[model samples]
Target: MLQNEQEYIRILRSRLEGTMPHEELDDYLSDYREHFRIGKANGKTDGELWQSLGSPDNVAREIRVTHLVKKAEGNRSARNIFHAAFATLGLGLFNLVFVLVPFILLVVMLLMIFIVGVLFAIIGPVAFVFSLLQGGLPAFSSWISPLIGFFFCTGMTTFGLLMVIGDYYLARFFYHVGIQYLKWNISVITGTECSA
Candidate 1:
């Protein structure tokens, strides 16, 4: 049989009950309930209201994804972030290129910069030591003057450290922007009349 308002609410509650807190879930469901009530008042049947809202399952999935992403942003854990990204990726095929590929590239680039930063930070001291020991250890000697080597190493160290710091802020900025984008995508691209 085609679902009615109660059935629709039951399905949504079943899907979201365990994953989200009660208050939040209630707040979320209230929007749908209001939709149904308004539709009925306007002389629409339950089936029509349900159809306009789209599939209950799709609505639940969108809510789940949004909640998970919000949770990840609040707590900031790797697992949470991965789950959010993965959920976002599951939204559609377009996300494979627009979301997944960019996310992967961003993670790789951040890690590379962080590793390079740490390497240069460590190498700077080692190189300074090498320049100092050049007279005794020919192999350790730098081709440039010790003074020039000192400045170069110092600059590299500073630049690398700055890169890492900048990358961290960039990650945070992207995280916020990503959440906004996901919210928009879920609302606009989900093939449903989303509740405001």
Candidate 2:
């Protein structure tokens, strides 16, 4: 019985020294000891009991593989979720930069130009009519009215275009930064050693 217990202790120690978790090690050893005790009671010698349990290295390897498989599956699930979220957010940002922001800015610029043009168009005829009514001269006597409207529309269009370009580049910069951040975070989580 002493020899049987000593052999069990040796196997347990070696297995525990490996990457196996403490709870699993304890459970495996407890079950094996119980089996050994039963075999001893049934007239089997300590050597026979140890042999029946098979090679300690093989048993340890099996337990380690099981744990590693579980760990791998969990890591895979976490990685998938992480990747999905990153993809969604990146795409959303891309759309906002390349589509939504430019579209909205262009619409606003167009609306402003349209409103200004309409205002000038309305006021031009009214001023010309009032000037004719006054029998003196044009109150806003100038061909400069239409020219001002044209320049205003052109300036707003140019500004909106420049703003769209700036937004696009900024969005691209943010996308790259976000990607780098995610990569760094993943490396940290996975215990990867980053150089420099």
Candidate 3:
């Protein structure tokens, strides 16, 4: 069958239309057009150029992932990052193990840490207040002196606060590292290394 430039562009545009911004879609379409024009000028038929470029579906998938990753990097929003990660998964089944598994683990681990931190932060203060209001300690509390209990509770509160703060920094660090890793992974997968 004759695979013409228009047919390729149509497939690419249809795949990308709603997923990408108009200007970006136009830019990609124009780039493909230029490539075809140049190829023809160099004595390559549209079919030859199309064959070299691979299937339009595969090309569109790679382009979607690259664009999403860049948008995530630039915007630095949860929605953007999630979108990028999800788009990366579309690259292949390999990503289900590599990308999706790690992404799920990180999110679950972070959420668990945050929950523990918040629980400690709340429970420590509440226990301290109960100890004060009761004038004496309960059986479990009686194992330690009031002074020791106070110190322990204070330490717990401090630890919780630090955990929460540390978690924030860790998340930020992970975001930066994850973005770079995604870019690299996409490059390796799509055969298009980002200059940035």
Compute the lDDT for candidate 2.
0.57
TM-score of each: 0.49, 0.35, 0.56
On residues 22-125, what C-alpha lDDT tens digit does candidate 3 reach at each position? 89899999999999999999999999999999999999988888888887899998767777776776656768788899999998998888888888888777
State the lDDT of candidate 1 residue by residue for 1-196, as single tens digits.
6679999999999877756688999998898899999999999999988988899988888898898889788989876676677666675676777778978888888788788878877777677777677732234454667777778778878877887788799889988887877665554333222344
lDDT of each: 0.77, 0.57, 0.82
- What overall lDDT, based on C-alpha atoms, would model 1 receive against the true structure? 0.77
Q: Number of the top candidate by TM-score? A: 3
Ranking by lDDT: 3, 1, 2
* Cα lDDT tens digits for candidate 2, 40-89: 89999988877777766566545554554555557777654443343334
Could you tell me which residue pairs clash in candidate 2? Answer: none
> What's the C-alpha lDDT at position 59 in model 3?
94
How would you order the candidates by TM-score, starting with the best?
A: 3, 1, 2
